[model samples]
Target: MEFVERRSGISLWRQIADQIRIAISNGEFDESGALPGELALARRFEVNRHTVRSAIASLAREGVLRVEQGRGTFIARHTKLQYPIGRRTRFSAGLAGQIKSRGGFLKSHVTEAATGHVSRALELEPGAPVLRLERVSSADGVPVSRGISWFDAERFPDFANRYESRKSITAVLNSYDIEDYVRISTRISAHHADPATLDDLKLSPGAITLRTEAVNAEVAGRRLEYSHTFFAADRIELDIDHQAGTALP
Candidate 1:
């Protein structure tokens, strides 16, 4: 049996849809890969048949399930893209062979004094100047991840402007004569999508997100960037490279 929260700030049908999506991803269905009938699903979810139908319809629209008029609903061939996270975690390089087209665009940018978290992550003094950049990354024309990054404003005062033209963080850093940096650490968590994340990632209500908090540093271990990235759970999965070499550039 499956459980759906009644007062979790999410609609019942949407919650059911989310659960069904997750089940499909996990291959919970039988060998035929077809979902159970509406009545069975309703019973499992403790909802009405109409609500179950609504959930199925939503999944069908999202290309997660195929519904034939006479045939039952079956899982679609929408495999999640695997994204590698390693010491040298370049966005474009991470998804190179997995996706034909990849892009990152700045949504917003601001320069402000670093807060405690940002200051500590970047090893800057309290209230040190920093550039905050909001960006969205797309794979095959579909938005897959949203990221917020902070860089030392004193070192990269023109970072936002450079990124607007470069469109690649690596390229922008190169222009500043900082040729190489590596991921120092990454912390990951899962959560329900917020309104802003839903809008940015084009995800439905109650969608799950994989959030990664990362810090990048130069060859000498000087912090260069701090970022928080949210990835659509259905669209991509993180592949952690535990054997990634940390050789300095």
Candidate 2:
């Protein structure tokens, strides 16, 4: 028997939907490739039949389950994409073989004075200027991650404009004559997706996200970029590569 947390700040139906999606991914229903009837699911989760119906409807909208009028809710072909994180992690390269199509676009940008955390991450004076960029990345036309990144405004003053044409972070950095950089440090955590991330990633309420905070630096050890990325946990898995060597302090 499964239980729903009434005080988890998540709607009961949403929790049910998220769990059903995970069970599908785990092949719990492979024998039938279809979900048990609403009444059975309600009994299993200790929810009302209406709640089970709502959960199934949400999964159907996400393309995770297909409902046949007379048959049942069947699993869709959705599968998690594997993404690798290493010293030289590149979004496009990481998803190359897992997906046929991949792309990312800048969602918004601003120039601002660096705050405490940003300044420390970028190794800059407290009030140094920085360019902040928000972006969303997709694989096979489905959003997989959303990221917020900061770069030294003094060095990449036209970073946003350059990225508009380059469409690739590597290419934009190349335009600045900085041919190489590497991951300096990375920290990861997991949490329930925030409302904004839920909408951006097309995730249902109560969905989980894998969060990564990282810093990148030039070969000479000058800080280049600092970013926070939120990946839809059900859609992608993070594979950390220890071969990247110890990151600098």
Candidate 3:
């Protein structure tokens, strides 16, 4: 730890977080090793213990450090578990609930629909309308995956507008009278992150990601949504479960 400039205009916590991230990347704190105590870091950085903890929290969310309540903060081990999507759920609700259930954090929002593979995946003709959304789900402050989801434009005419001010995509669909739907099918595959994907995911080159392509439809099979999500394979393991007589709920 080192002292940050008093008048640097950057928040103390942010400065601490930046330095800590740099330290980790530079191997100053060995990978999978324990970080300095909060008290010690505060003393060195000349900030409050709370500030140091906040910094630590930020790093942890980014998958840099692992903090255990009783055991202290350690360099995060390379381990990630993909929570199983065993049932039908809305994307916002599903990830938010799953993160809470397993001590993770989820940040999601909407973005502009860009032309490319996303349009095709959503089965929209070239330059057709589409909903663009992004999700960052993290465990212990480390980002496990960053997802960009797309939906057909014609069917969701105001999708982008609705999501701009709201966080719940499901609620937006509900507003359109799409009360319920089923996931028609999901296709899962693995590949190295493309340049854009890697940048958004904050990953090194060649990092593996699990891509899930899914189409959702109403009871009558009218297509409602289409999505492709890429999850960091290092931080999550997708668990597929099967049992007789259990429809996706």
Query: Residue by residue across 82-194, what tens digits does model 3's lDDT show?
Result: 45653354443445544543222234434355476655545556676566666665555556666666777657777766765554556677788888776666678888578
Arrange candidates, best TM-score first: 1, 2, 3
* Candidate 1 lDDT by residue in tens digits, 1-249: 369999888789988988887787777888888889998888888999999888888777656788988888898777788988889988888888888999767999999999999999999998999999999999999999999999999999899999999999899989988899999889889998888898898876667899999999987899999999999987899998878953222
Better by lDDT, candidate 3 or 2: 2
Which runs of model 2 end up more than 4 angstroms from their true locations?
246-249
Per-candidate Cα lDDT values, in order, are 0.88, 0.87, 0.66
Error of 3 at 22 (Å): 26
Judging by TM-score, tell me the better candidate of 2 and 3.
Answer: 2
Model 2 over residues 1-249: C-alpha lDDT tens digits? 368888988888988987886787677875668788999888888889999888888777767789999997888766688888888899999888888898878899999999999999999999899999999999989999999999999999899999999888888999989999899898889988899898899976667899999998988999999999999887898988878763534
Please provide TM-scores, in order, for all candidate models, with all chains considered together: 0.91, 0.90, 0.54
**Model 3, poorest ten-residue lDDT window?**
240-249
Choose the strongest candidate by TM-score. 1
Instruction: Provide the clashing-pair count of each candidate structure.
Output: 0, 0, 11
Look at candidate 2 and tell me the lDDT of residue 142. 90
Return whichever of 1 and 2 wins on TM-score: 1
Q: Comparing candidate 1 with candidate 3, which one achieves the higher lDDT?
A: 1
- Model 1, poorest ten-residue lDDT window? 240-249
